[model samples]
Target: MPNWGEWAALAGGVPVTEERDPARDAARIEQLDPAYHHHDPSVPERIWDWIGEQLDKALGSVGVPASGISTVLLFVLVLVVLAGLLWWRLGAPRRAAGRAVALFGSGGPAGADEHRAAAAGHAAAGRWTEAVREQLRALIRGLEERTLLDVRPGRTADEAAAEAGRVLPEHAEALRRAARTFDDVVYGEHTADAGAYQALLDLDRAVTASRPTLAGSTS
Candidate 1:
């Protein structure tokens, strides 16, 4: 092999150089303008598109068109929303009625007056839970005494509220709330205060004072 300087001398003495053009580089950079670049879709748009794509795939599997699937889905969604609203508005009475059937056992108060006296005694001692229980009992017994509620075995507080609500429409809300309070204290193991006891007492008094409405009337 020839030596390094001898090889260079043997060949034409050519100096290597790198050629750069600022104008050409600038033109290349301008061609890559961010303003003209395509942007990824927004998060919500992407999600909606993904959902539509999935729906299309699913519908296509069943030989359904995407447009028809959209219409059907919209209808079903509207129906579900309306059903939820209706349930929110009208489900209370039915739930209260169901809860009532499970509130108490076979034995109940002998008389409304006796229960009232017991409730008063409990209130005097500041035993609000007992007071609430006895007052609710008084209300139930009072209804039974006046033949407002049938003498059914294993009556529950919620049941009594429902039955009395039928008889006394004006106190229906109060009756329902009072029954819930009683259940909270007894079954739910919640502590009752004076306010709870007073509410039940007021409900009892209202039920006793109100005259029963005609049968099968729920206003």
Candidate 2:
């Protein structure tokens, strides 16, 4: 096997001279033309080329295309403007309306609890008509909250009933009967008894049990 120096010399194309003189060799190297024979730094040329290639690949990987980025930014801006306009104009009323519609049919107030309270208040005041009216209103409001009807104060029980049957097939019968009973007590001059009150309570229970509970429901 050849020694390291022999191998290195052979690899480097160094001549195998009979006499090895360090100073002479140094002098001979120095005598060579500086313009034609230049010394390169130890770093390989392929290292620099590889670094540049890797940089290009890294940039391609890290950054999205300009066109794609522009399109995404435009879409975001449109959504922001639309949402801002809607909030400014309607003040979340449409969302509330939708939620109320989901909760009762019109999405007016929160739940049957509110109706029960209103009815109780009316009953305590000895206003049987108002109590009955409130009870019916509770039922209607429940439907409205459930998103079954578009509840307006001026809307009649008949109209609400029809809409309930159409919009909330599940709770239509309850709404219809409650509307009728309320109308009877309020307009038809029927005296509300314990049975009427119990009926209203029963209806209230049914509504609370059946309808989905709405968050942030308002009157």
Candidate 3:
């Protein structure tokens, strides 16, 4: 019921009435107001906390330890950092070819050895398009040096392949294919890869070793 005195009064003829404080009720409403709730987080805080919660739920489902989750997050952050560093060092991967003109550009005429060296460098750097172009250049230049094909100014890839094919009849098809790859990378607005580069390199070696036969010769 109540304390001894209150119980005694209740047992007697006295009645008790509950009292309300209007000031206290107004203060409670003020405490619940959003603008006055300084302890609550802002929008950015809510977003960041939501991301962390999602990550925890995902990783926890895989039975990752709470500490291990941090480690995994740090590892992913490191990979992203390393990618940024690589882009800074080697530049971004291009969707289009280099801005140079096709087939030897405007530079002075380079020897077969020079072109081959350039192709090797590009291959090492994972620039397959440039590598393929340079290797094809080396193939044509080497044949010219060997007197298997004439070195004519302003000669195109198709013309060079046709002329060389006539002299090196056994490799005519290969030479034509190599020329097409060269044109695709350099002028036809296409890309190349490691396999294409390797093909051109093999063609160059084969053409260098083979003896040239005159056009229409049975030999």
Residue-level lDDT for 7 in candidate 3: 84
- The predicted structure with the larger TM-score, 2 or 3, is 3
Tell me how far the alpha carbon of residue 13 in candidate 1 is from the true structure, in angstroms, after superposition. Answer: 63
Candidate No. with top lDDT: 3
Candidates ranked by TM-score: 3, 1, 2
Q: Each prediction's Cα lDDT score?
A: 0.78, 0.63, 0.82
lDDT of 1 by residue, 1-219 (tens): 866766786686765445799999999999799765568687899998998889889989999976798897798899999998876544545455455544434565468898889888989999888888888888887888788888775777777788889878889999988887887677544688899988788777777888888877564
Per-residue alpha-carbon lDDT of candidate 2 for residues 65-125, written as tens digits (9 for 90 to 100): 5446546557878999999986654444533422322212244334545866877887887
Worst ten in a row by lDDT for model 1: 97-106
C-alpha-based local distance difference test score of model 1? 0.78
Q: Give the distance in Å from residue 55's predicted Cα in candidate 3 to where it truly belongs.
A: 53
Clashes of each: 1, 24, 0
Q: For every model shown, what is its TM-score relative to the native structure?
A: 0.51, 0.39, 0.51
Error (Å) of candidate 1 at residue 38 is 51
Overall local distance difference test of candidate 3: 0.82
- TM-score of model 2 vs. true structure: 0.39
